[model samples]
Target chain A: MATFDLNDEGVVVIVGSGAGGGTVANELAQKGIKSVVLEAGPRFDSSDMVNDEWGAFQKLSWLDKRYSAGGWHGAVNHQNLPAWIVKGYGGSTVHWAGVALRFKEYEFKTRSTYGEIADANIEDWPVSLEEMTPYYEKAEIKMGVTGKTTGMPHLPWNNGFRVLAEGCRRTGRTDYDSGPMAINSIERDGRPACQQIGFCMQGCAIGAKWSTMVTELPQAEDTEYCEIRTGAMALKVEHDDSGKVTGVLYADAEGNQQLQKARVVCVAGNSIESPRLLLNSASAMFPDGLANSSGQVGKNYMVHTTGGVYAAMPEPVHMFRGTSVAGIVGDDVYHDPSRGFSGGFYLEFLSLGLPFMAAFMEPGNTGWGKSVAQGLEQYDHMSGVWVLGEDLAQDQNGVTLHDSEVDQYGLAVPVVAKTPHINDVNMTNYMFETSAQIYEAVGATDVYELPAYPASHNMGTNRMHAEASKGVVNAFGQSHDIANLFVSDGSQFTSSGACNPTLTIVALAIRQAEYIAQEMNAQNI
Target chain B: MNGRLSIDVYQAIADGVSAGADADEANATALKAGLGEVVAQAQALFGSSYVDIPDDDAREGILRTFQNEGFFQGVRWAAYFGIYNNPDVWLKFGYQGSSVEHGDYIDRGFSDITFVPEGPTLEERMAQVKG
Candidate 1:
């Protein structure tokens, strides 16, 4: 591991070594630019990963002090932990299920497509799908996403997916298949093929799934220009008198404070922490936050409108025998305003281990009793689908610093405030009913509707906009107020498209790297 | 009474909560420390004789009363990890433990579905959609 001096002011400092930060670090390193990646969690290799869900969760999940508010179920159920993002060297990419998807063209122009939704702050993305296509191709190829530029075949249909596919067939839905996933179906990129681990969310033990932990971070380290410092929690982004970010003040592993100087600073700490860090860095020059001239740093938070539906088959399905999310039914993933809702959703096959099934099968932790026990007893016969729908961005839903509570690092705890829009409720009801109907069409004995898990696909806090007054960052994720500061994570999402956000995050990072490199050569900072 | 739960008491609670599954056969020592904390909390809430209550209905009622409590959640979560993660319990539930360690079920049974209709091959589907 290469270590750089804290006074190295020429290096770029990237916070949170997840998808965006890790990819940006490697891409910059490949361009011969030195970077210092400060990750808030420990470094763990594939040898440190486990197949057990709770064990892996303890090893990877960000258990920091964060409060939840508003009327979202997570506020009451998962009050202390509103999101399921990781805080490790690779961040949540280590725990991702590898459902790689690109946003549709219509999804990019949501404000124009679904015009004037009540009480929503929707906007069109500054960058369109046409502009993002080449970057998406590069991201897909680099991540070895099956069924895309890699041309590797999609993973085989597991029994759980077969059950869902059969149900979709009976319901006359034609757009369902094993999804385009980043998990390897055939050995490529020097990684082994997925061995049907059934524990993709618990960190792919064999490296078949492409995570920045295994792919980008290690390759960045090999470049000798990139130094990844684990257990370095970024406290604030410090700026000079002229309002340009110059360095980051972070807490080391031993709770000692340190400052690492940088010419450019990129905030890639997911959505919540990215905004929280900016909010925490408030100074006299920038009273609102680092790049909060629009007061939109942490506004318009979104975790895809999500829920789960599990049905019991008469015969054994062994849903846990294969991948956690192997297939997707994209029939409903189009913008069909006729469905009594503006946005669309995807029904992806999901199979949780017994512990999570028992814990999260219902809301508020009341998933006990004889009925719940009976569901667990029929675990082998249960097949399920996770609903991923587009959540309209609303300015009221956001992350804010709490009034009194402070974390272990003495920073004000972030209170994630969110309330499901009526559109979200309507879409979730439609999804649940449609899923139940599909299962019933295939002779399912009983169906159980599971509430949304904690935010996994978190997005949109430091969103991109064409104008400086509308959002915190510009099209290329450069902060509108601070030229040298950037928001490189899902926080830069303009709209919460009805797809997994990791691929979009990677594509945007790749595109941003080129812009950053050009700006550096031109001495723009 | 150092407030530690005994093996027998843990077994009884495990059996009572396992919904008639053979939870007693699973190891309790691994969870002894955590369950002991739960037992201390339960004792503080329902008194020491709560574990010795004769009627199953009464015992279940007490457990249900503390359903949302931390002690109950702790006990239930610990029991779940202890009981469900056991190889014996996995066998009883027909779960094949950790298929990746042995090998993927690709050639064996991943696609040997009897109930579902076979979808078109990936290449065929891609052609139809892209074309």
Candidate 2:
């Protein structure tokens, strides 16, 4: 960890070290700009990746035993599973299952398609797919993503692509073309190519996948001007009378609060904490909170209402032999209103459930010792796919400060309130039917449908829109009210496009980093 | 006066409220009326000798209801092991032997044993249950 005097200046403070912050830090450091990235979690590497399920879950998760979704109201008392969102130096990219897809062109212009969803503050994104095309190219090549996908400006063509494309052709669904992913089939940077080990979600013990700890952050460290400080929690940005970022107030590991001066501050914590930090920084001048002049700091929360279908086969499928997700079926996403819904979905084969998780997910009839033993015997024969769908951007699904709940830092905990749109429900049911049909197509018997509530992706909180009233961030992901402050995570998504968000997230991060770098060089400050 | 069971009615009300019953606000008016009938019945049964009694049945009933309801079975195995394996808890509930003996208890459905280890904890050759 690097430490600097509070009086020092000319440093850019990036709040998170995840996909967005890590990318931004690397880009800035390469431009000969000094940066100080403050991450709340500890720094870890491939060696730190644990083998046991519980150990792996701890290394790669944020929500813990103590944290709850504000204890069951409109906020369901649900335990968020150990999803790909990582807590270490690499962020989520470390443990990601590594299936990435870009959003479709129409996902940008949602208001035009859905005709202004009821009670939703929907707006067309100021930037389009064309504008972000180059950044997407740079990110794909930099991260060494494999598989040829259609509807993108640049990428290689591969066997997975040919198979999925042929499958789509056979089904007569033109939209079923395979999209490019971030996982490496053949190595692209200095790292070795993937051996196709299925435990990519367990943090890739061998660094075949590109986590920031091995990729961008290491490069940023070599630059000498960048200071990476893990276990440092940034509380708020302190501004002078001119309203430009002067420094940041943060706490150390031992609960000691301190200040670090900076020329600029960019917050890149994921949708949950990024908005919470801004709301917690309330002052007399900004009663509602900093960078919240429109008072939409934590509004329009969207998590793709993720559900799935799991099936048992007669023989061992060896589901854990390759990547957690090898292929995707994206034919279902479109602007069609004839299906009596506003949104749609995509599908991909998911990893096999581990022993304990499989035992728990088994039906209620098989709960005792005999039943648990029987379920364990059928572990290898199971395989499934996720039904990743879009959630309507609604005002009702928002994050607010829970007055009664205080975290370990004495700050008010973020209370998330979610109410699924009727369209979301309809689209969810549609996806269940589609999943069953696809499973049947793939010759699956004894299939079961998973319910679609308590969505996992967790996106679209700090939405980007053309008008300041409609969103918290501008088209370039800059805070509309605070000139020097910016946001760069899934929070800036306008619509939850019916696909996994990492490819889009990485592309957006690259674009935003470029925008910031160009503006800094032009002396726009 | 007499050895009467101490019935903590307040505890029963609290338990009822926590279990999501209509005891607190929903039946407050009815409870106020029903107290008079119980008071008169108590006085008629043992005049000047009536004493407050603890309702051991309520405590036992709560435990039995939890067992019957099958709540927190699949979930919270951590809490289950915490109470289930503790020897003091087994002794209080009138069960015998160590955690290894739990299998036998499961089969018998009574969790009782004839002999307990004794005599200064010297147990290498103890033959208490051998006969």
State which candidate has the highest TM-score. 1
User: Which CAPRI tier for candidate 1?
Assistant: incorrect
Model 2 clash pairs are B5-B53, B5-B54, B6-B53, B6-B54, B7-B53, B7-B54
What is every candidate's C-alpha DockQ against the true complex, given to 2 decimals? 0.23, 0.01
Per residue, candidate 2 scores C-alpha lDDT tens digits across A327-418 of 67777877788887776678766654353233234323223343343443444455566778777777777677877877677778777766
What proportion of true contacts does candidate 2 retain? Answer: 0.00
Task: Report fnat in order of the candidates.
Answer: 0.34, 0.00
Q: In model 2, what lDDT does residue B60 have?
A: 30
CA lDDT for candidate 1: 0.86
Sort candidate 2 into its docking category. incorrect
How many collisions per candidate? 0, 6
